[model samples]
Target: MRADGSGSGTLSRLEIDSLKAGVRIEDLAARYVPSLRRVGERWVGLCPFHDDTRPSFNVWPDSQSWYCFGACRRGGDVVDLLREAEGVDFRRALELLGGPPAGATAGRGWQSPLPVAVPRQSEAEPELTCEDRAILNAASEIYYQSLMTNAAMRRALQARGISLGTAQTYHLGYATGRRLARYLAWRHLDLERARCLGLLHDRLSGEDGANGDTSGDDVWEHLSQRLVVPVMRGWETVYLIGRATREAQRPKYLGLALPKEPLTGRGRPRRSQGIIVVEGPFDLLLLHEWGYWRQFELLALLGTQFKRRWLAHVGPDDRLLVATDQDDAGEAAAAELMAHFPGQAVRLRWPEEYKDVGDLAQAPDGHKIWARALSDA
Candidate 1:
């Protein structure tokens, strides 16, 4: 019943279950995942299914499971990792683990060793066809749900005068526990698909070699402790920016690497939200809270660079508001925006006392000064 004279890729559900139950999570993960080591009660490794520069994958033997906290966010038995890493069908993956051939039967009256139930994918549903947008939506929902329940993140936003209502309005969320991988596993999402979306790290260069740095900032969970601000084009999530709330955390902001072509304005623009390009999400939030966003049609550049896709659909009448920070990089970015759109651009200046919009918004007599500047503009 096979096309290539080999057996079909189908295996009994019971046989696959037996293979998983018989194998240890650590052993399975170590075989496919690289540079694995015991970390306290669990094992940690770089995800083979993605471009992992740091260890985001973990295996818990007691639970007989593994999860990748990074962009992959997928967790399951070693069998899942095998299927992903080897790029093989489910039955082929099981065979690689030395499981019995297809059509093999368990002995009479044989009972499963573990009570856990494995999720089955129908023969008609191929794993290669996972939806990237759905994966991002699921991951974004997880972060949003975590943000609402996180008291610390809520307090930090409140301290910055960002009310819960405003946060929800802007879709501000949190990534806690650095366990997004486990959550994805529970949700039955795909790690490989998420990688292509720039949500997960790519292990392209030097992945096979162990650098042994274990730098905390580059790991998947680095986003876990930060405030998650998603860049959305209508219902679709385009990119994610994580702002560090803790003083000890270096590099105030981190974001995913959008495809170079798309970032350079090659793709279709999502909406005509008006191009009021500010440097950061907080800057955009401050302006929104002060009623400047709608009056000027604001958007956060999310960084200093200009992207083609973000600007591809700009209308001739669409206005440009360059409210970059006073810092060197910010000034440079603002100058670039001005040069890129000469006649249509309006350059906004920040007060000498502050460096960015957030600081300006929090300064004494901030709103009056802002109103005067906007009026002049």
Candidate 2:
């Protein structure tokens, strides 16, 4: 455990403000100081910061704050508790609350105790070209409409407990082997744009010379035989992802190589009080079926690596619920999400019997378990 909180990633003032406003110090303190007893409106327990025979630590759930009237006399919000308990600096504290890695390069790090943005860097992300953006949008829509017409794709959703209506709401679609190239040709869309979206690779002049002329032999449809789901920011499509429809597909999922949008002097992302991040789009579909979206802003990250663009989707005041798959990679993704977020983000662990939320939905008592987790959260 490195306690040198020198500096690393940077968090904005707004993000810090949001974290302080979002995390309740009492719940945080409970992680360090156990055997807490509620008295009046505060939870009193021994201060873990120092040796104490009597309970001198008081955490106010209503105020969403904490303080110690004992020897340590050192008390603050969840960030402070993490700092002292972990013997790390404010930056490390923020990381513990989901800032960045403790050993990341040094800087002012985050000014706010709470972080809701990705670790600040010295440079901004490169902008996507118009053609790149166009292909993403077109391919997404093409796959979605194509999925609606495919019974196998719809059946895949049904097997997962996802309703067709839910799929439609998400604009879920399928990619027929060569439909995109034909559509592009019919619409006179740019072939270069299609190539950029990974829907087409460079056709060799020798091998496929005249083969490209026919739709069946055309190798342009990148996500062929997969269900396409567009990753959107509000109403705008930002990225395109594919889930393999066949069990024999090696990777099971595929994605465009386009870079996700990062925060760019955009003031601040809209606050939704609470945000829930899940692994695949289908997980979101399941939650949507249960109307969970009404309670929290549900975000499906397609696969879990915690894209930089997702930072702009979160507000400093937002509380995050990470409900990723319960596996090694999923756990890694959850850790990454926490590192990037300064706000209060709790990972909702599924029972050992279930692999993920989507898998759990198939269990008879799954909804009951889900409801319990929500109620406890």
lDDT of 1: 0.62
Residue 34, model 2: lDDT of 85
Candidate 1 lDDT by residue in tens digits, 338-357: 66687767787756778877
Clashing pairs in 1: 51-201, 51-202, 51-203, 52-203, 68-181, 73-181, 264-308, 265-308, 265-309
Model 2 per-residue lDDT tens digits across residues 1-377? 22222244444443444455545566667677886877534577877877777776766553355666556644555776777788888766665565555555433354444433443344654566766666667777778888888887789888878788778677778877667776776767787666655566433222221112335353445466777777765545777767766655524665654553221111123544477778777677788777776666777776654556565756676788888888755776776677678557777865777877877789988888987776676
Evaluated at residue 243, the lDDT of candidate 2 is: 78
| Model 1 stretches with alpha carbons more than 4 Å out | 1-130, 195-222, 260-275
Please report the candidate that would top lDDT against the real structure: 2
Model 2 is weakest, by summed lDDT over 10 consecutive residues, at 260-269
Candidate 2: lDDT of 347? 78
Q: How many collisions between residues are there in candidate 2?
A: 14
